[model samples]
Target: MADTVSPRPLRRRRMAILVAALAAVTALACWGAYRWAEAEARAALTLNGDLRLGLYASSIRNAVGRYDYLPFLLARDHEVLDLLDAPSDLRRDAVNRRLETANAAAGSAALYVVDRSGLALAASNWADPAQSFIGHTYDFRPYFRQAVETGSGRYFGIGVTTGLPGYFLSHAVRQGETLTGVAVVKIDLEPVQRDWAAGGERVLVTDENGIVFLSSHAEWKYRALRPLPGAVTDRLAQTRQYDRSDLPPLGLHDGPLMENGARLVSLPISGPEASRRAFLMQELALPEFGWTIRFLSDLEPVKAEATGAAILTAMGILLLAAATALGWQRRQTLRLQREARVTLERRVEERTAELLTANRILRDAQEELVQAGKLAALGQMSAALAHEINQPLAAIRTFVASTRLLAERGETAMVRDNLAMIGDLAERMALLSGHLKEFARKGPARVEAVPVARAMDRALALLASRLREEEVQVDRSIPPDARVRGDAVRLEQVFVNLLRNAADAMEGSGDRRLTLTATRNAEGWEIRIRDTGTGIAEAHQFQLFDPFFTTKEVGQGLGLGLSLSYGIVRDFGGTLRAENNPEGGACFVVQLPEAQ
Candidate 1:
């Protein structure tokens, strides 16, 4: 009875095993390579474009510096210095002649001076019929006030005399400690504008007030990026900055932040040269001057990169297929040699081996679902990082003001202490700002042995001010020696987000309590964060971890905290469970495998 199987049965089993393995390999090749190829190609293209943009931004920053050098020299000029406090027609003429010579030599629009009372002292174009500003008062201008108050100011505006827009560079004219007047130099941006137009590349530079000071496109000049505040608009109009120009906001579709963490927008234009459907835009901030530079890139290079990746993927699949076919052919030859002597018992054994291999393949597919869910949840962490950073920044400002008052009162020792505290606050803010970039958004998918208690401590430290503000009570029972396989910072982010969410939920509740409890079992360690507040609503519970889903009112939240935290935990090979507590609040449980 045991010898009932025939040689034909043995051949069929071998064929079945080969077919299954081939199908599995084929599916893996097609599915995996597509995603890998696309991501790699896109990343490479993006990096290239970003590098190019960074180069141009640096150039503009340096250019601004170079253009201001002569204005700084004019501030220190002996002729201009003498005319500040005492200006007569004879003295003004001498200063004007000297300024005119320098302005022409330096290729500036004009060089002028203003006293503390805002009266125009001298001008480089004093003799020009249509472009002289010899006796106008510009005390109402922001640049005039900024230079008087802060020692230096840079502003862009249309000249009342020349009727042309230009950047005004002003430096305080001070003899010893006594302030006298401001040395003003108007720089005509024509040189930069010409370069931008000739380069055939889209370039835009917006000032601190969000107005476009420089752009290749004529229509975009003097346009605003954001709607100007009414006060700012009135000031601009009163100062004659744009000189009767109606500064409208630019039209565009705003996009997500780039890898470098800058806002951007796509400006659509139609022409023969504008072949790309839409521009890939990026904004680079000139933090020193409170300016933003934006560049729009063509899509041809990225398309080429994508094409190359597809070709490579196809070639790889074909090579793999050929190699696998060769391997099967050789294996078939060897099996055929033994076919003549194959027994009924061996045929039954082959069938059992094939079934076991099939079972193993199915188990692996289920494991990949965890990674899929984590990826789906990762898209919402960007705004969460911005939200977390605000708290630390607000604290830093408080510390700085306190430190300044102590210093002014000659309390040096206390001042030093507060300064150190402020530094700590600043570092904490930076850490919060970078967490999204380093932990979730840019982190490689992996797990590591992490100190569970240390992560909890860090999260608690960040929420210290919030906890005090909300008057929330905390109860902790986590063990100091507990460790798990996960990323420490990311795990800390998970707890920080959870704690903050709990604080928001309990904002006005009378009994605001947060409980942290940890326990270990055969499977792994479990951490529970329970809050005494209104639990998540039944209808919204399922979507709690979905991207852009929030239960809070508009402007209160971006609905990203729980989703980001969920993704972080999942990426660490852990489970993040959310439910309504029996005690009348929300409970989040984090389950992490114990470190080997």
Candidate 2:
């Protein structure tokens, strides 16, 4: 009787074993389903977060780039240059008006010009007695120092005068080769942050040092994501980047990394365990601006979804085991299992629809960014391109007027000549328009062996009327073999710019002489255009070739002549420079490499 063991007791022991086995299988199935669902959910969230992060970065970049051209453009203004050249009450008044108007039009927080010594000469806020930046010295500011050192600079910090946080964009203002002053435009980025907050997005932007300067949450501003090094802290202090703001660590703890460089992070709120919240964090780098953007999505929903999936899986497994053990209720168990599967499928379908919506939104954002970029580029090149075509248009106007007179006088030969000249001018205008497109695109210049004398002759012919009007005595001295490796059309433009500048300089001078001399150098042929006028100021000589650097009044030039000429010559493996001649005049030297 096996120690008097009852059959009922044996059956009960067997049933207990079977129940234990089913429970173990159900638990294992639940864990597997939870892990699989969690992984899938994290991957989807990271992908979607990456797209949102990119869109945020694009918006910030576009905002910064939009104002990048403003400082340089304002620096080129004649009134701003005048204020720096000769500081006077009247001139300051003019500049104040100018800056105020420009600031309003540009929608910048403030616009001001600081002399080389960092003294504020004129400001847009001159009217605001409380916030006027006039007479302040900003030499200690890194933005001013950097602009003086480099051609341009950007900085983010609290304003010393206004005590408000803003981004500073500065450009070195030059009259010829001299850095006379700095043109600064202070932009308030609070609006951008406000937009993020309005969207209810958990986003933050950190500088190179990991200190959050902009955020959707106001409490996160000026806080460090991690413990900052001593050196970085010291640098921030020196720059006054945050201006007396305390940068405490956010105590971010990393948990596990997911696909596409996203990861789980736990941040403490206030309490012990209840205060901790998990976030799926994704970061995108704005390399151009040396900034990082983070997008945080709450993980509570994902956890809930994974738990639901696990529960469904566990229930199905238990029902299948029960069905196998109890043959009578097998049909009912199967029906329950099918209903559980249908519920799971419906949830999955809902998730798929959400992902599709996210994808469409991202696509639309990318398209908008592309279109905005295209429009901005067109706007920047429009002014320079217009300047290039204006010269030919003016000449055409004069020729057309003269042709009308000749036709009325029955001078057929002269009229025929004028029509041919008009045709040539039209062709030149077409070529100029095409070249401008290439220049804007930064396409390579057309390289060929170009005759220097012939190019100069064409340039002189184009400016013949201007030279006559100014009563300039032109002299040319070039060897018969004055040929160089260059683009003929571009070289002609360079010559025309130099000659036009020389004539302008000789204006109101007693002795107006334009002398051209060419000589061979070790590198190439050196051509000098000397103008007998009040020679360039010693201060301006160094910046003569810099782009948008001009001494002429506004509307007369866009300060692109020498800069464009320098680039064209460099493209042909040549050099362009300016200096004061020993004999009381300004001289321009263009050297081109010898023909191969």
Candidate 3:
């Protein structure tokens, strides 16, 4: 009878344990699903940003190329017809023939001659030969106004009478400041729209007033454009490229639209002739014209995938909870029997031991991760630093060899020259050592009044060996007593970094010269290090001062020289910038506050 009573309680306890386990597993699954969904959304946003920037750049380049060519066409057509004195019936007939030839040659849809009154006198396509155009005035048209103003070529958008959506290339045919007629070439919008719509995304080309001039979807063509519904429209409007205001109040969001439920990304194209600040929701631009192209991508498929993953994760968690509940029920009776002898202190001790073991493992893992990060950073900088130090080291070796040879010869004059070289080399060595010391120097820097010329001298001294080794001539134009308030050591470090960088830049060049100039500006003192070395590519200018980013060979530098130098200058309330010099090579400018 006791055994039977125990079995009954055991069965009830097992059922209770099963229910609890199922609930826990279900909750865990739901949590995991939520986290995964959030991550997927973040990843999608990142991908969108990268793709938008790349495509936008490519499209802008293409548009600029096309726009530049349009001017050439206008010039060519104007030259061909400018030889004619006056508009005669026979001459008009010849002009019509030439217009057809020019249109075909220029790949333009229509070529025509319009009088000052905006009447079409001759056209390649004479489909609608209207006598009314001869007296009709087009002085209000953009192309007409531009031609009259500039006395050359201009671009104009489509108008109501044109019937076709396109841009016009027009040039004023002037006979000694007297405007005779306008030579116009029309470029149909279909080709550009077709090219832009090649990717599997909706594309819209619009005018300044949000009029849909061209679109991949025919339904949208000629339609009055409306803002896409949902947070995406707001995101597009809030982008720095479009909206100039700080940021939108609601911020940006990613997802399907409430109206059509289509996933999309909107890009704005801004171009000239459009309003000064018109925004395009597309992927292309005409910088000269200030036109923008907008490209939108649908996100439905990605959403579907995310939804499926979330559902699967939830189901898996529910299954895990069910299994846990079953296991818990099986141990309920045994656990209950043991509970009678177990005390809270014993359980606490067991838990404490488990926690201690986990903590030890975690601490070991964290230390390893930190060490790995340091090694990675070191690896990146090794090449740049080696190159930096190698130049001075090589110079020191050369000076030593030269001095030894002079000593053996017993030529006093030659020995003096060699001795001077040795002294210069030693000063450079000191400068380099100072730079290394500054890079490794941590904590707050010691500030003091330092003569600007002295700081420049120290930097020049540090790079002298390298400059000599690379055959780079240095011209210093620093004034005496040019002092500034800063840490002497840190200021020297800044100069050393800049001078070394200039030397490295001129390593393999024929015109290996560096110019160092300092002058007092309105703000304070400005030091310029200009070199005739390989100029920096526009792409790499911004990344030059980033820590551990190097363009040097392996084991030569750590890419930290400039980055460290930049920090040191900034700490003393100074600014450092790099730019491509007009004559050749690159220039680094360091500006500091005047010393009291």
| Top lDDT prediction, candidate number | 2
Q: Candidate 1 lDDT, tens digit per residue, 1-596?
A: 57587989899998899778877765666556555654554455456456656766765654466458655666777777878867778888888877776565455678888888878888888897677887788888778999989998988788777788877888888989998988888877666656666556677888878888788677788888777899999877888888987888776667776565534456656586763245567677888778887777654444444444444454455456555555555566666635523543364465446445534533342232111111111222334566566655766776678788988899999888778867876776666556555544656645678888888886887677668878899999999778999866568778888988888888878999999998998768999999998998989878888754577763466556787788878777789988999979999999999988
lDDT of 2: 0.81
Model 1 lDDT, residue 380, Cα: 26
- On the 0 to 100 scale, the lDDT of residue 127 in model 3 is 40
- Return whichever of 2 and 3 wins on TM-score: 2
Instruction: Quickly count the clashes in candidate 1.
Output: 0
Report the error of model 1 at residue 467, Å: 87
lDDT of 2 at 474: 91
TM-score of each: 0.47, 0.56, 0.40
**RMSD in angstroms, candidate 3?**
19.3
Quote model 1's TM-score.
Answer: 0.47
Better of 1 and 3 by lDDT: 1
Off by over 4 Å in 3: 1-35, 38-42, 45-73, 76-85, 126-137, 151-162, 174-181, 194-200, 226-290, 322-596
Candidate 3 weakest ten by summed lDDT: 372-381
Tell me the deviation in Å of residue 54 in model 1: 3.9
lDDT of each: 0.72, 0.81, 0.59
